[model samples]
Target chain A: MSAKIMGFDAYNFNFFWLMLLTAIEVGVVAQSENMAWATLIFVLVSIGVVKFIGIAAVFMHLRFSPDSNVLTATALFPVIFIVLLVLMVGLTSPSAVENLPAFCRPGYYGL
Target chain B: MSDDHGYHHGPHEWSHGAPHNSWAPIIISIGSGVFLFFFAKAFTMNEGMNGYIYDSAPLPLAIAGLAIIFAGLISWWKQDFSFDGSYEPQATHGSTPFSNVDIRKVGMWVFLMSEMMIFSSLFATYIRYRTSIDSCYSLEGTVVEPGTACWLPASYFIAKGGEHAHSTLGFMPDALVPGAINTFALIISSYTIVMALKTAKRTDLEHAERSIKVRNYLGATFCLATLFLVMKMIEWFIGFHIGPFEAPSLLSDQFTIHNDAYTYNYGHGAEAGAMTVDIRMAASIFYLTTGTHGVHVFAGIVGLGYMVVKAHKGGYGPGNSVSIEYFGLYWHFVDLAWVAVFPAFYLY
Candidate 1:
């Protein structure tokens, strides 16, 4: 059975909706002032991840491709990179963290 | 039947035709090598290197390399299009992982994968710096150095009207209007390109009236991509004050640069002091990431311009739509890269 949401083509409509949703999410994140820094960061990062995957799956047609191995391998790079980033940040000594790149320093959490 | 143009008679002859001599690949490789060598050399050179002046020392080599590279590209393109049947899609090896894919499509995919690595490294660097910096500059211009347990108060980073609290690491504009509009433009352009590919595939070039539809769609895609660039340039001019102009632009009033320290005022009036931060690393990362993406966008526009010209001549059809699909993959990848970049640089 063909999957259609809101009477639109599954692929094209999904992309359009995701784009709108992301824009809305960005607007909310930018305008809302009450959210905690950690919450704001989490929301923005989650939205970015979703948007990236959505574009790759639908727009790039990786979701429907027969060779999932190659597509998945390529997709794993970003995940691995992010994980490495988190590990690096978490494991670094406090003194060492002070010497990390300017934006990576502890002082610029939500800026 | 055997022919003079290197055709041979055999049971496996259909798959084993004699290879024709082509200089395009070698010329392009040589040109690209020369360009990259000089380009890297020039970029990496510092002051007082080998007793040579740093500013103008590599100019000649770089220019010559660039000229040769362009010449090679133009010649290669001309050579490819010279033959009548040159546009025909090639057969792929049936035993390979890419058996069902067009060779050009596979090539484009591989190229994009490499590009992903390039952006990955840039983003990784940005994230590393963003998460590790330990110093917080308060609105009152107090530097909170890293202690055994360094922490910032909530008021130091909150976004306020007209003026928000700045962090020592870096500060992005809180408005998000320019970024949101640019995002929408790029996403819409992706849709238009997909539509262009669909129209091109359905087009019957034998009928002049039907062919025009393909051209129109491609033209629209071109215009939309151009619009994305225009919007981005406008945003940069206003937000970063990057373009050439004497008059003060928007956001210019918010930024204050003193020595190596940069301060951003997030609150209104003189009551809220600016958030002072080290500007060098933050500015460098910002420019490097966004600048690299903009270069990719510019390159896509140039490629789209070529495709539009070819579409006008009825160069694409159902049998030869692989080129359009290839271009679509690249264009979409560009959009995908922007997806990550917007949030990283603007919203976050």
Candidate 2:
């Protein structure tokens, strides 16, 4: 029972695939022009999140570690604070939220 | 008879052995704290009416503090490696919640948590400023018409004279090739580090064979990391026009333009000089974020260099590879931070 996902041989495999995917993502973002600014930003951020998770889970061995719960908690707990801070700034600060892209605005997106 | 009498007592008793004591780490922490305080103070101090800067005199204090801190750190490292007073593993704290985990690993994780907060604050600052400036730019059309437009994307700002500028939101060159290549180099280095650790952890290989393998892998990792830095420096040089190159200094020439906006092509006329693209907030955020990440990469290189020396000396193996693992954690974090930063600062 190896703790690694898909066994030991797959570690390099996973890394290679992830790297290729990240390069492709960058290329797509750079070349694509038809995308809405908001949509492009959203896609870029989403890809970044996925790449981060891949590195953490595979390279850092978070998935295979005995104390995975503790590690995951330590890594993720600050995200709550980040989300809260963004929310507070977006809602309260007039100047901060005003020029946000159309997707972030309330009425523009039908929110 | 005396030895037997001492052996009767538990290991916790002082008689078991002399307790560990070293002043270097404490001195280093104090020095670092002092250095940080004065360094910050030097920046925030006010310039007086007669041109004498107030509170700026602390810069010397900051430098002295940094010197003391580095001295303490070097002394500590030497003491650890010294034959006369080398480090000995201490008994584990039995009461720890993570009884099964190595205490050093736990310590590394805690340290990483603090690092996360530091980066979080930097990211927050960037987001706050970027959104606010964008908002200001958006309001330009509606509010009292300003003499010039408020915001221009980084591409337009960098393109000489904004000649290629199509709309208020024009496509700017993001230096995509350099960024992509650097990303690849870092990813490869990450793989090599894992290979080094794996080689060190293998039990079946002869000690000499494992040592060679570990050193080779570490050497490869170091070269790749250095390659990444070299690429980064080249990118900055070309972008900023720091050398004799004909390209404009993006920071000084374009970002500083204040009240007026116009368009020209550096490509069209050789004597047109540099195109100005003044969006101070965007320029500031870009430099700060990328600059901070570059500092981290430099630090990681130093750590890897140390590891390479130790590997050559046969310092790590299955039973004593914690140091390598800790370094790996730090290196991985640096890579992870760049993952977020590349798209935010470059691609987007």
Candidate 3:
């Protein structure tokens, strides 16, 4: 995007953050024995979201570009569907995994 | 409608300007449908009401479908190969929100939106199973019978190191080495591809020098993507050893889609409490999700391959660099997908 962040190139800045966050992600998982599993998961997910935003916003030029808004909205158009899919399958059904159709389960299609 | 260029039969013609109507899309769809139908038939040809037998009688028809698909692809590429960014395809005539934007860029985003749906559905399935089933570790001391299906996350084998966990890397398990390296490789490749686009758009540099720089950057990106897939193979099938370093592949660790009776050691040495479990679901989803990501990487590798060849031929420059920008969009999306996948699949 040719934009700058903290006087550094935006892509480089975002790249640096992505790498550091990924290292922390791996480090947290490696140190699982020393921390609570819940904490580890939280950290992993938090870093994951940040890294996702970083890649999408900076690397993908969804920020600092003239077309960012329209394109970002275009990219996010599937969020509602994704949330609905997760909600229907994850929260609404307590036994969604168990009730999964035979064809959809593992070893059914032999993939 | 131009009289000079009668049709899109030549590589020198611009695509968006002509009244171009091609059968490639329909041909591809027909080929895909034929391939899928025959592929299904191939697997079921030997099935009978009385019993079961293996059969692949329809395989040739499926291969023929593949041939058709390839033909369609060649038709599409031959038309697109000569595009030098002379005409930017934009939705300018419409009152739609995407007016004045490159239609190719919009198409890319829309395509990525659909991809988001696919991946989100996959993640939904992962979450569904991750929550619905009891983890194998949680059932270590339970009264559950053997052969019960349970979640034994790939992270157990990768991040925590299952039965064959080794500390050769000192900080992380040896198995984590491949995934960790792949993560960085993708991130670095993201940078390199951007550099390629930047170099392609440079106006001051000599044509030879700019083309050389762009080709190098793209070539570096291609190498990194190849490295990512190679590491995936090594982590999934070929266990490796380097002096004091050793990491077992998932296959070597008995994690596969067909594994219905996996031997899960409960972190106890040679104990009677060890139990047999059906870890096929976890293994399947692991492969399904990461395998899907791997497919995307492989696809990127193919695209990068073409781009490297094009750059080598000095086919990119300030006027045509939008190709690299569009490609960078896809490449960054791949990196973004891995951002979620590496943590969810390999770390957590």
Best by TM-score: 3
Encode model 3's per-residue lDDT on A1-111: one tens digit a residue.
579999998878888898898788778777888997667777888988898888888888899988899998898889889889998875455776665546557997687
- Regions of model 1 farther than 4 Å from truth: A1-7, A65-111, B1-54, B79-96, B135-175, B203-207, B237-259, B264-271, B274-276
Model 1, C-alpha of B86: deviation from truth (Å): 7.7
Could you list the chain B TM-scores for each candidate? Answer: 0.71, 0.69, 0.87
Q: Which lDDT tens digits does candidate 1 get at residues B154-236?
A: 11222221333332222223334445667887787777777766666664445455457767877887887787777666544
Error of 3 at B60 (Å): 2.0
Model 3 CAPRI rating:
acceptable
Label model 1 with its docking quality class.
acceptable
For each candidate, what is the lDDT?
Answer: 0.58, 0.63, 0.82
What TM-score quantifies how close candidate 2 is to the native fold?
A: 0.76
Rank the candidate models, highest TM-score first.
3, 2, 1
**Regions of model 2 farther than 4 Å from truth:** A1-4, A7-10, A89-92, A105-111, B1-29, B34-59, B79-97, B135-174, B238-249, B256-278
The sequence of per-residue lDDT tens digits that candidate 2 reaches over residues B266-329 is 4335433333323545555667777788877887887688678777877667755556666788
- Comparing 1 with 2 on lDDT, the higher-scoring candidate is 2
Task: Give candidate 1's error at residue B222 in angstroms.
Answer: 2.5
Candidate 1 chain A lowest-lDDT run of ten = A89-98
Q: Give per-model TM-scores.
A: 0.72, 0.76, 0.87
